[model samples]
Target: MAHRCARLCGVTALGGSMTRCVLATLLLLALPVPAWPQSAPARPVAEDPEITAALALVEARLETERIRRKIPGLSAAVVYDQQILWSKGFGFADVERRIPATPRTIYRVASITKLFTATMLMQLRDAGKVGLEDPVTRYVPELQLRSRFADSPPITLLQLATHTSGLSREAPMDYWRTLRFPAVEAMVAALTQDGERIFPPYREWKYSNVGYAILGLALSRAAGQPYFDYVEQNILRPLGMHDSGFQPTAGLATGYALPEGDAPPKPVFQPDYGGYGPATSLYTHVEDIAKFISLQFRDGPVGGNQILRGSSLREMHAAHWIQPDWQSGWGIGFRITRIGSYTAIGHGGGIQGFRTDVSLIPALKLGVAVFTNTNSDPDELTAMVLELLGPVVERAQQRSRPAPPPAPAEWRHYLGVYRTDFGSRVRIRLHEHRLEMVPAEEPAATPVVLTAIAPHQFRMQGGWASGEVLRFEVDSQGQVTGVWIGAYPARKEALPE
Candidate 1:
């Protein structure tokens, strides 16, 4: 069981007037408002010393870890309910320029932007402009697929949102290297002509950026607005996310540190993808993302008005599909997981030089958003934040529910041999009930323990890859057939008996 700190942190209250004063003070000092309240909440008025100490420890450890990992800079925030408990920036935002990361520094959120895309789709559903079950071909008739399976089933908007559209993780050709903002029409055409369905649509779950790119195009067609413009009007503006948008204009911090020894970070070349972003290109500061997190908590509003209906939020939180092993489930737009007795809903994002994590615990009316400008591991940081805030959230729950036991062993039955079409076979074995994948002919392969997520689904720990859920399929005889690993594009072929 992951240890939860028992220390209680006294809560502090900042009135709306006082918050305004603080903002004014920050503006005068030219310092960023690291902490800002999205809305006032009734809670204990004293800051918890123990909680503060724990948080300090976490911050210190993160700084050390960043240096040790060769990560150049980081900016992070923590929120509870709608209140900003704490936010801070560490290291250099621009290593070459010696500029420190600040609350105002904007970082590429990568796939975390997908949540916004999904939320926009939900908003369209609320407005009766789009249906979740509507066929993709309905909006974009030119959409096609290489395989009959990909084209025959008639992909739905929901499938694209949830990544069951049978599209590859990315386009067959390297769009990142070849093109700058290739037309959606060209992308769909290329996918239709060259893409192969690694798995049958809706038969399993696979994470696909192509799916989201298609969804972005479909949403634009449905709304009769450019993708970024539609999101700005419907989602960003209404959410009061002034600091959040698809592109970073002048005044935003730049020259962020790239991963050491990794590819050097370059300026975003394509204005179309960066400017007309959807799915994976939104830029945001930590405090703004906290506001978004609070809105997700419970009955909170977008732009001080309820934009998503209560039913819609519930549908967003409800499990949309069960993974193959049945250990964890995925909701409409969020990845669902239970840590200890608390249920968490949110997503994690990774780009070249940044990592972002947002988690919401509605039962406690609490949420957390952590953003870093340096590409480093977020798992430990997330665990620490949750640990610091755990006691307070538990107190709010009003019930002493013991931590849930680790997932059961039947979930491990899917562990076996898998062969890739490239004549490579890998063996997934159970060690201490955790799945360890070993590639054949690799003598010293480091094994990544597959953390039980839902049913036959599991995710690897550490970094941006932690939130991905791997699903395994079975034959009629209940033997493992093939496995579709989420995040990565390739599927693992089951080895012959």
Candidate 2:
């Protein structure tokens, strides 16, 4: 029968129905049918319906503001977790050529450059080659600026990173007005002769571009490499920010001075920061900036390079010096700002005709970057984005957050009331797959979480007993009898039917 069906299938391929013949042959021989290969399902995008709706609202607001402010061109992006949720541009990169601005349109990012310098310094600090408490003079002994207060402590690297170094705000030259920045050696020499410490070290937070310039020079000396080289090799390249550079480069958007009244916008000539590049000389686009923003959201590598440690990034985000207003402060290289219930850490930049702002909301793992060709407060755009998109992403995260893993089957043996030797009673309950110790008297209070570290040992989270080891005592029958919380014994109560 198989031979006859095989011959029938071959004959049908020449004229008759081949599908029917093949089916008959397979049935006769009872051969398994081969399956066609299936293509993989499409990956889910980061933007969901809620996020899309919020993005529409954000786009409307951005367009309205871009026109109202008379910005020639601008770019903006929103990052959630480790992904860029949305990015776009408005107006024209070159109004004369009618070139439309896009997320790839490059612009001078100004003071945002300080963040790169800060990250490099933090990397060196974490590598144990330099100490945060080390004096600035240790690296730059050629620095001869004088302090008015004799009792003031010598300036430290921490003070420099936090903007409390008491250094002058500029490089002791008319660089901003002249647009002719000095070289590193000449700038340091001029500063030594003309500059004076504005305030005692750590006395107050005084923003000093020259302080960061000095820091970069000192960092170079400590790392035994050029400052820009260190940052480029360790940070920009590792983060794959190839479009970013400290000099004028291709794809740069023409910057325009803020137009006066109805007069046409005047294009401003771009200038290089020279020795002060570390503080305000970065030229980049929204796409590369998005990569940097994603770095702030997680600790792992990007394209196989670990830019900075997660703990160090957290330290950089923490407030090192707070302003008198209580709403603003300075982190290592970031600006700490408070908006209602949210705490944002990032930086703002403005030089000549360009303006930019970046804000990272650590709690939500969300960030926003706004870049404009013409001078304007990009921070306003950032605030609106956070207000509009932040809540939606946060709620979505809460909804999508995976449920806790199922409790172990053996966990039931440890659940019950425990009477401590000190006459205190605590109840161990399995709530939401977590082992929590609830006070018997105040069950309404927040319970302390217990995390399993071994077969019968757990660690307590929070309270005065944080980090203390907890061991469950088991009987020969494998039933839990009591628990030992750092040598303090607690007897378990009998289970009721």
Candidate 3:
């Protein structure tokens, strides 16, 4: 392959401090079939030490976090290239019954629901029934809300989808203590009748739950059915997310809260979604959530149904507006977060007693979903697991990949210690006619061989640096001066030959 290093190579002591494993089983099962109707996934089985060790690290973090946060229930899953590699749960779904949590355990995934809403809207746009640039007035002519920038530009669907519409964060209604949200027509009237003036269209990024509520209303009007109905028929049923819905299902985990004072776990409060089911109402377990995530990674349905065209899904991932304070951007309904060099495009949700995070690394075809009860945050844990996972996958790929081509005789001229200071030197040496590199302090350390892809630049063949390039620098005297690996450069030692 032209880009051999791009393969999911094995893990080592990288960003996550993972231990290197020489013996790893191949992850080369045929491309997995998509998640289907009520179908349970294959049980996780890893004979590879790398995968096993990575999971052990994740389990340790999960247990510690759950105990520290006093979480009642938690569930998580790891996916790669359309396959669910690991799915597990911890703590309890019911404390009284002592029910052990599992991947199938249901939790109200919260605002991750917006991704679904965006999917439906994209579907409408794909069908030519609606346009993203069109004004909300086209669909819901009843909107009473006003904008100070009315003369500048009317709010468009794209702005709402990207959270730049300048709409209020939510509908003005009494849904909180009562648990009874206003009907769709009532919410429309609430915005329009009051003539509430918003910040200004596309002036700055401002997340608005009410704006999404308006989207659901317009989607309902455009599709000639309620948002929930359209989603169920077109998305949930086809995607086989039978356990997901706008209301709690049978056997769903009870929400709980741990207050500041000494008190038993109590039920959590509900902030009425106010007929805006798209912004929050959806509930599901990791099993079902994994199905939706797997679909997002595929270009076209390989062994399953293609929910949306791959191109459209790619369009949704494009960063539209940035949140400088957070150092992240918004991509349609997806919330972008930096995961080292990769970008995790997904969403996180926080209800009174629950917290949720769903992330996808498109470049790696990896997705992670973490759900916790009693409002524990699993974000840090999830990031740790992802960082570890990259190496694990890379290791597996390295083992399966072909060996590197031997280096030419000229390569010996570039072999030596390279560093800014001798105490912190990196050694480059010739091994079996292949160029290998390692830190000077560890002579027995696993050396990653370089594969020649150009005249002076080569990519690593294995270990942590696998697929990364090293370009040797030459001085005016035609002497090797240094080498650049990734973004870091080091000078060659000036010792006698």
Top candidate (lDDT): 2
Model 1 segments more than 4 A misplaced? 1-50, 148-152, 251-276, 300-303, 396-497
Q: Which candidate, 1 or 2, would have the higher TM-score against the true structure?
A: 2
Please list the C-alpha lDDT of all candidates, in the order they appear: 0.66, 0.81, 0.75
Model 3 lowest lDDT segment of ten: 17-26
lDDT of 2: 0.81
After best superposition, candidate 1 residue 93: deviation in angstroms? 0.8
lDDT string, candidate 3, 1-497, tens digits: 31232123322212232221211212322233232222333232233445665666566556556665678788999877667788899889877678888898888877888898899989899889999998988998878576666455777888889999888786667666567888767877877866465677766788988888888888888999989989988888788899988887786787788645555567776565657688888889988888889878878632346778898888899898878687799998998888877787888887777788888888777788888776777677678667767656555544444444556777877888888533468788887667788887786999977778898898987766578888999888878888887667888875423
What lDDT would candidate 1 get against the real structure? Answer: 0.66
Per-residue lDDT, model 1, residue 236, is: 77
Which portions of model 3 miss their true places by more than 4 Å? 1-48, 269-274, 301-304, 403-497
Clashes of each: 16, 0, 11
| TM-score list, all predictions | 0.66, 0.80, 0.71
Model 1: lDDT of residue 126: 76
Give the distance in Å from residue 483's predicted Cα in candidate 2 to where it truly belongs: 4.9
Candidate 1's residue-wise lDDT over 193-297, tens digit each? 787666667777888877888888888888889888887777777778888887675435553445446655443332346322566788888888887777776
